[model samples]
Target: ENGEFKPAYNDTIKDYNTILEMFDRILNPDPMSYTSPELKSVFSKFKDLFEKHYEEQKELENSYQVQSNTSTQAIKAKLS
Candidate 1:
């Protein structure tokens, strides 16, 4: 299975977690489960990509939240 990712059987976005949780699962899958070097390598590579994406998404969300909260606070102050 060179360059092929194993599909998560019957899984959907509804099962997904926030960015940090995703990163945690990637870097910490059950070590006893993988018996081949190739598979392990692939897992590592995939995890790296996932972790990067997670970090980027988390940053974006945080930034958006900060802006939204600031705007809300400003609006509240003006209203009062």
Candidate 2:
């Protein structure tokens, strides 16, 4: 087994929430009031980054699940 610890689904949720909270704080006092083009651009970039990381996290979780299932199946096959 690898000595590294992969992030779990809960961990990703916490991370995503933290990101949102940070952005909320940044735009606090009137988040909807930010209508400037530059602020919109920044917001768009943040959204893109969030989406990219979410996709990557989803893939990692899926791969981890597949690996776990395969290992279980292999063990069962051997015991058969």
Candidate 3:
């Protein structure tokens, strides 16, 4: 329950987008001079993990879209 950043693998797309936006703010704070080296290092790790999750989810969505479109086209062809 710690407010630590972790990948929300099963979360909906909207939730994932919200987490990404928050993480972006955390990784790039307005006053960059105030962040400690250790904190920065930790945030960097979070960024890497989050980026991987984002990419994986993006690929899945793209494949699903392709499949949906193909199915729709096949249905249309059969109907016509």
Kindly give the number of clashing pairs for every candidate: 0, 0, 0
Alpha-carbon deviation at 29 in model 3, angstroms: 6.7
Model-by-model lDDT, in order? 0.70, 0.73, 0.78
Residues 1-80 of candidate 1 have per-residue lDDT tens digits of 89989965444653335544544555566666433567667777877787688789989999999999999999999999
In terms of lDDT, the poorest run of 10 residues in model 1 is: 14-23
lDDT of 2 by residue, 1-80 (tens): 38977633335446666767656654452655545667766876887788798999999999999999999999999999
Least well predicted 10-residue stretch by lDDT in candidate 2: 6-15
Candidate 3's error at 26, in angstroms?
6.0
> Candidate 2: TM-score?
0.57
Model 2's number of clashes is 0
Per-residue CA lDDT of model 3 for 1-80, tens digit only, reads 59887754555665666777766666666674366678878988987898898899999999999999999999999999
How far residue 75's Cα lies from its native spot in candidate 3, in Å, is 0.8
RMSD of model 3, in Å? 7.2
Assess the local accuracy of residue 33 in candidate 3 as a C-alpha lDDT between 0 and 100: 36
Best by lDDT: 3
How displaced is residue 32 in candidate 1, in Å?
7.7
